[model samples]
Target chain A: MASKTQSKTTAEFADDPINASLTADDKIELLRKMVRIRRFEQTSLKHYHAGSIGGFLHLYIGQESVAVGSISLLGDHDHVITAYRDHGHALAVGMTMDECMAEVFGKKTGCSKGKGGSMHYFAPDKNYWGGHGIVGGQTPLGAGLAFGVKYLGQKGCCLCYLGDGAINQGAFHEALNLAALWDLPVIFIIENNGYSMGTSQVRSSAHPEEGLAARAQGYNMDWAQIDGVSVYEIRAGVNKAVLRAHEESRPTLLEIKTYRHKGHSVADANAEKYRTKEEIQEHMAEHDPIDFWKSTLIGEGVITEDDYKQINKEAGAEADAAAEFAIKSPFPDESEIFDDIYWEVDNNTEAGRTGRHFFHG
Target chain B: MPREITYREALREGLDEELAHDDNVVIIGEEVAEYNGAYKVTEGLWKKWGDKRVIDAPISEAGFIGMGIGASMLGIRPVMELMFYSFAYVAFDQMMNNAATCRYMSGGLINVPIVVRGPANGGTNVGATHSHTPENIFANMPGLKVVSPSDPYDVKGLIKSSIRDNDPVYFMESTVLYGMAGEVPSNDELDEGELIVPIGKAKVKREGADISLIAHGRAVVSSLAAADILAEKYNINAEVLDLRSIRPLDEQAIMETVRKTHRAVYVEENKPFCGIGAQVSSMIMEQAFDDLDAPVLRITSADAPAFYSPPIEKLQLPTPEEIVERSLTIC
Candidate 1:
């Protein structure tokens, strides 16, 4: 259950340090989340490179902790929905690696029964609504899902994730205003990678840093801006926003200033012509979420170097197994094109019949 | 025990009976509360149910309409009113994106049970922007269910049925016929106030043998008038079918009637080229080609704007005289 008491503010996230006496187990779990996301994306990136997967693939490489920390705060009853750049969030929300990879490969064993591909993954059992594609398209849908939560009297909130590029779309504004006016239980998180495709935030948006959160003011919503790369800070920022949403039946906006390690998609070369090599290297060294967590865990004696190798080895094995399973998994029957277009029956959905349960609830 | 009531009142009673019985149902739109709706279909609902149930909205069609989609996605039955049928364009994003695509796009995870109502079809001098019928525009979409009820009975029964349907329904009422009175049973009867006419079912107003006169929306009434004139004066028996729903058209009914009559005349209030009549005609020609004794005739308004000028408006919409003339030519 979410705490009714208001937590610390967005600025407070940067100020509050992890207690110096923190347990190794706690730090291990945090580091595990970071590793899980990193390994998953790396595997997916490898698959995309090998020409095994087709269609648009958006990897959440550097921004793994944003989803891990925020989703960790949510209960089983809570829901999540985001844009095409959604593998990290889906994995963090507990969708199996096999199904996620299968979906990317457009196999029968995939989530959405291979119909959704990368941009339209839906894990309803886990309360993950979708993997939408059209820039800001998922905002209104997220608001609707939150509205569903209120309508059914569910004691949970929906985390609506979008990109910095998505903020400029009209649906975002319409959804935010309506969510606040109705006081729907939703937390809107804008993952500001400082670019909407090739265009930088400065060129695309007039006030990029705070503009996303400021738009919430028209709806009188609680707003925050945070250093998104810092795992502890992102965790605190999301936890505070989630608390307000659960208790007050209100929506909050959080602007997470993060950077993407990979280029926009597998297509971009990330050539130094558009942006300096120094900037890319600066982000890799200074703001790499996984590196920061690994160092912190090691420094605190959370786990030995052996434990780190063991976890990475397990992740690699898991990714390899997932790839093997997806490759071996028969292509979905051509007849399956007609299936799952409209959901039928309550307990026996297609995803369940396939022995892949995205959500327990 | 039927009595006279306007199309608007019938719709109101239909909504009232639906909301009274179903706890999950609610109505939201501009002026649906204090101002009693622009067409007054939701009169006195706000004072009775309060703002929570009969929501009064700001002039944010895209916002509230999207809210309705969100509400429906969550399990609430929301009936949204697009102030004028013309203003429905403002919220097309919600209708097309969230309402129509949720089930297919979500890979069958969500069902959006939403009803958007307004007056469609031309006439009453609302001018070019406000007065053109665009139900055909939506009728072309694969996922949506489009309906245009032409009478008080249909307005009542169809609205009740649309409320309970799982798919998103686009219910277009008429501007000119909202005040047209007709027989509607009292609320005392068990099924009187609440009538569920299944979507995509055509109602045969009058069965005849000479020619099949098919129409919908305001044209249904116009076709019926033409049928009456043909029966009384020329003694030509023309079967008139009121096509209540447009998307999943009651093709079986139309094909059966065309098989009997061997000639067809489709009347529409919209312009001639590529209108709903064209689609209906194509379907008939494709399926019932051997049954046709003559070329299928279509009585539609001229291919021009629905201007404010009376004569131009008169030329740009189908009337009873035009339907009769077209039917006689087909006969």
Candidate 2:
């Protein structure tokens, strides 16, 4: 109850104007974060079109609010691991956009020190385990991390994020069973973008499932569904889930219902063929978390339209600057190729010595 | 300094010694605690160490194996037993991606000091599904130390060393040799602490001049038998080298023997193609080409799956007679 009250009331400050619990600076910070993700995604799409970014590039456009809301609820000490659609997640976790952009550009300045490209990005110093490319790969790893925290007698839990497609994997079941069996402190987030690659949920499933959290029933886990588009909803949902996991030392699965505006990747030939334009328009009107946040913040007098515009402008400039830095950065040297493939062996003394040592023991 | 004991008893003693020494050490697997382990390698451990350690895990390999990795990640040294070696394939994903590579993936953030022990190779009437010699698979994987001890002495020393080492070790116990008796050094008998057989080192079982014979796991015992036959009948004193660990192969020891002996013969229980023998042979050619007096020879199982028929199985596998004949021809 103490944790629930702490998390739920923490967000009321931004929700209620009379209470004024959230400071003006906090509101500005939130706006800046959302704007940063928005600008980064837009510019990244341009880079993708220009063939600067190859491989599978899944833009975090409509789902920006989820990262903003959930990451806002987390502290610097908290750990996070996520699926391949991870640029926004990394930025929210406090990695510089230039490093992330360069990582996407496969430049040496990337967050992974340029070894791991966009998908496999890992920044352990910042408590980000990785940007795992495999769908359900992060669940067991996240659970193991939480187990480590608990065993070491630490005060942190791991927030493991995956996609709607990943819940069907065997690793998800194995991870959840172990997490529940051990009562590990972990927050499992399923960002349900309503499609597994090009196939719709209806096509993938035999029985129509309402939310990703429903599958948690198979493992007898604590679960809930939320409107992921709304930053307020995501914040409230994650805050509750995270606190519950930490306090009870139990794993909680939060299924955030959101939609991706673009196709699964850049190579979708007939993106519009899968779904009707009417369905897209309907979601845009009913469930645009960005639009909802703007109206709520404005209506509550938390910020003005001019403030929003200035934040957007600043974010755009920052994204442009990051792209410029990434493009100008030098490619990795050839000498680096042989290094870091494995742990370097230090045998400098033996290097100069040619003959064998003859000793009688 | 040596007392006779079975391989199974030696393994049990190893677990007992580790638990007695380290408070962080724990044992988990199917029937490992209450039922005295599937192979009974952990007999009486539960009574001695209590239930907190020496846990009896459920029938979930992935779950318990992942738990072992999780526990190891937090400084708990867990020695997990997969009842049968063939079943390890179920937990291969966790073993390979998580337990094996966690330290490297985490930028050497921590070490995984976990030992997965089980009985491998087929001598029992168990079907093809239940019987598989997967030493090559574990040997092929990086970030893992694979050790297969042939006798009680090596078993006790290697198991103790694996528990103390700061790497994930896979100890494949041969079921065929579990009942076989051999001398193991006692605690009071040893002047120092427990004997630690270094990883990636080979032991020379017998010395000879004509040809060198390389083997590992249970095949080491088989090779010794073959070497004696060659010495008695063929008048060929074949040098026998027992490769204890396969991953960081005792290449130096192997090369030294091959170069001196002038002829080499590799013996293994598994099939010949792409086997550990192939790796050893290629390395010998690469490094000791000038010293070789004759072509390298290999004695291994045929390119066919092992079946129930003992007569057929005998024909399929390389025996002492075959080894002596091969040694004479090569010499």
Candidate 3:
């Protein structure tokens, strides 16, 4: 089976050295990550329906390659942040599946200790800033993360991801201007999944025929658009932006075209109302990032059909075990509610002890 | 002897000391670098430390403030200056949601050691848009710490403490009181150490037993004036208390003052509805209800958006006359 040709927009940077440097095992690992993320989302959604997991579940089913490909290129100083559809990024950045599943389950053993629900996962140690919920809220934060990197004199960058809907937010524009003017080492990755919740990109955003990344032109920053379905293409394009950020302390706006098979969230039952079932099916069948990568690896002889099946089996088992762990984990104790609200209050410092930190106490 | 400095100078001194104290502390905001500052509270520091230390951001409050919050999570202490605290509404979501909840949401894995400081009083006659006193609003949030200093001494000390705090501190100042001079500990007198007025503490501006006049920010100045009037004209002694920190409120100090005076009057520039006074009034009633001689009365700004006209705006905020009258009723 032949892999699809690289999109013309990303053709200039298609031959990224980072892709060439990946060994057979590393390439197979990327496939495994994508598979794991897919299985995780599927399992989480199952529990969501079964009433074990509560709140909204923004499944990152079809967009696994975007997180796995881009995050695999990050170095020690590099950081990543994304909007609510963040399980892929969280898993890609080395968060345990158990912790990620438990976080969504709202259990005490969760990454955020059951404080942040599905929309807010954070691993500062991994340089994964958060799972921000607001549309364009993380844009400024992404730039700020880069600002911290520059201030500390570290040669690293921050990858800030947002959806097509967030493009229209004033905060994103302001962040772009600041990132450009200050020469902050940050990459604004627009995960263009066509629709902003229910509204399609065409209805929610305004852009030239050059596409949404062209808005970067207004900020006097470099921009590119890429086919997000291919992990090879995502790495090829994102690697250039990362290199530019490291070497020149510059910012780039890279719009990666992708799709979500599920609705905005499990709560967004009207996902089928705005777009047709046929469009979703077409994307799932033809352009599924996981399936596309799986065939590409097979064609390249990196992994045989049997190896792919083994990998899928392992990923499925891991995801199922994570769900079991989440279900068994107890909810946070009632007394623990007052904890973690303020660093001072939790640490029992003079500032914390001096005042009434909690009203109830 | 302590030297007298304007409130603006006191704030600038605090920022300068912190910048010199820590390599991680940086000042960021619109016109905060080259143009001195919107209120000149950050004056001369830009030239002293250079651009990297003192950054001049675009006039996007949400962008810069949120950026500051992001930077703080990574160990950089950002002292963000909002031109007017009123403009905080422009970045309300960022301030209220992101900065306030980052610690709790991340389950204490991340700490936002950022300070957002600016004028937040309504008497400048900058109209309703510019003259918002939102100390009560920001104080209402749990994760955030709110500080509004009245005099130069408290401003200098509290600014330092707020910067050093490991949480998001909203330092509300007064444009009208920026030039007002009060005695501050001079640099030469700091042979002992740096002056740091701890957050969540109240200070007694004047001591008395007849009645207690409690306030924060510029209202403390008005309360002091009313206290003088109470002593000279009414032959009644009034104790004046300044709540330097609003959120981690000095409940002990408030209860003590209420217990001492038996009659108390809450004075503030914040609007009457859901204002700081309302919270204090409730606390007083709950803790010291039996000790109270009269119902705790509140003297707040008129329950409306600040008036644009100078005279009307002056009347819109709590005046010494109103404080005195309100105190007389309680006393």
Candidate 4:
């Protein structure tokens, strides 16, 4: 079983050796990435309301640190895959805001050529597999990515992120068993954001006190809990799992206590009804990851309030430009609908010409 | 001369040849590696390839199937097996939503070069839960390629083509036909590409001018037997067209057969409503309506769950008698 102990708060967390090794520039870059994600998500919500970006917009507003911190520690062989709430991970792994926003806008220049909307960003060249849409669907894929890394004799791990609600899914549990049974190099990051859609964690899951990661004990895999409010703590905690994967080819379950300020998606009309406004406001006021990190940087004399404002402004401008670029980009042509359905058909190989690959043609 | 081999041996030979052909190819499923396959189709593969190439997974279809799709995205060609095709419902989301759509959804950036193979047939007294023919269900999806080979020759060639095709191919086999023997190319002939059957190409198993019997998988065997009975008893010459691939359907072959015979009878082990025969019947009516001399009739399994009683179960699936009776009406 997972330990029932509470996660250490940012203030309670001791000096992070990983943070200590980071140069002043590296620390600022982490802060910048978080702010960039925040601004990108906020802009997406604004456009979503204005009827520009269609489909579900699962914002990564409050959980930016988890993606930025963990992804920053990834080596060349390391890979990343996540569920629908994936804008942060996409941007963290070097996917440009223009391509991502274009994808959300359903433009041809988008990362997925506008075929996959907000929930399906992919950059295989960068080792970012996808932004899978189904709940608990990407968990098995994550384990498979690790299996590929191990099979190819690569020295790295895969960081598969899922929500607290997904931990209850049968696929996720099955993936955990396979990862442990095979000793694959993967870290299942459960971003426990207090609520799954309308239901709170206590109502949706069992053993809330023991934490979701405790279920890792059932698989005989290592488990831990981390304070998601601190980027330093997230990096330190995930770094340990990455080392275990690289050196031992083992799996770990890390339950990062995080919070989401917005609704499950921009269209979740009952976001306020299910959870009290006070609860949302309280978390925003005290446990906001961005504010906590910004203040910590200021206290350390690495950055001032003026520098934070400048960074925020730049992120906002960059997001605005991306949205503008998405607006200007063209949608894919009608002929393109049948293009990517098969590799053989797309490349016009000898086998491609033999059959009626498309129904209409 | 090509050597005779059972359907099981042909599949094993195909897998072995592919594993030897490419280092990235692997086999993963429950009982696949150590247990030598639930049906013994993978006998001695574990010893030949060792554990790295042949892996055993728990009875977790969604986990391992989705894992194969993921690995395929990273340049690994994984051939995953389901102990029974009826168990595909457990991993339908992964197969339909992920493996089928990964390439299209990824804008052609990722290719899910994975083959999901298993026996899909009824009439074995395994009850309803274990018997299901989902070729039509999978063929309905746009991005998926559905193959249901009837004989050992087609099975060996199609399995190889499916593995190398760079798409998600759902290869539906038959447990009843696993032991059936048919002529297959020798290993030396295979090396020179003698038995490499292409996808979406139908074969004229037997030629006649009176009627056409269109079928796939085990039903092809039934149809061929019916053609003999039709010629011997009723003096009706029937053309048997084996529709080896369902999704990328060989419309040209179907039309040619229809044009030659001017009458058609579709047969399959699948149920009738919205089945593969239904699609073919609709296509003939739409494209070759003038070529037809009579309405195209269909003979299929009884529209109910597979019966557990061995005697009744034998009558539940399509048989040669059913095919001959249905063909007589169309003729």
> Pick by DockQ: which candidate is best?
3
Name the lDDT of candidate 1. Answer: 0.79
lDDT by residue for model 3 (B1-331), tens: 5689999999899999999999999999889999999788888999999988999888899999989988898899999998999899999989999998878888889999999998898887678899888998998899999999999999999999999999999999999899999999886688757788999989999999989999999999999999999999999999999998998989999999989999898999998899988999998989999999999888999999888999988998888988888778766
Off by over 4 Å in 1: A1-27, A208-211, A268-273, A342-361, B187-194, B271-273
Clashes of each: 4, 0, 0, 1
Tell me, by TM-score, which candidate is best. Answer: 3
Residue lDDT tens for model 4, A116-221: 9999999998999889999999999999999999999999999999999898899999899999999999999999998889899989888636778998999999
In CAPRI terms, where does candidate 1 land?
acceptable
Worst 10-residue lDDT window, candidate 3 chain A: A1-10
Question: Runs in model 3 with CA error above 4 Å?
Answer: A1-15
Candidate 3 lDDT over A80-140, as tens digits, reads: 9999999999999999999999989999999999999889999999999999989999999
Model 2 interface CAPRI class: acceptable
Rank list by TM-score: 3, 4, 1, 2
| lDDT string, candidate 2, A211-328, tens digits | 6687777768888888775566677678777777767788888888888877787677656778877877766676666766776678667789998898899999999999999899
Task: Quote the lDDT for A353 in model 1.
Answer: 31
Candidate DockQ scores, in order: 0.31, 0.27, 0.85, 0.78
lDDT by residue (B1-331, candidate 4, tens digit) is 5589999999999999899889999999999999999999899999999999999999999999988988888889999999999999999999999988878777888888999999999989889999999998999898899999999999999999999988899999999999999999786665675457899999999999999999999999999999999999999999999999997889999999999999998999999999999989988999899989999998899999999999999998888988888777766
Q: Looking at model 1 chain A, which ten-residue stretch has the lowest summed lDDT?
A: A352-361
**B51-136: candidate 1 lDDT, tens digit per residue:** 66798777777777777776676678989898887887877777776676667655567777889998887878768888867788
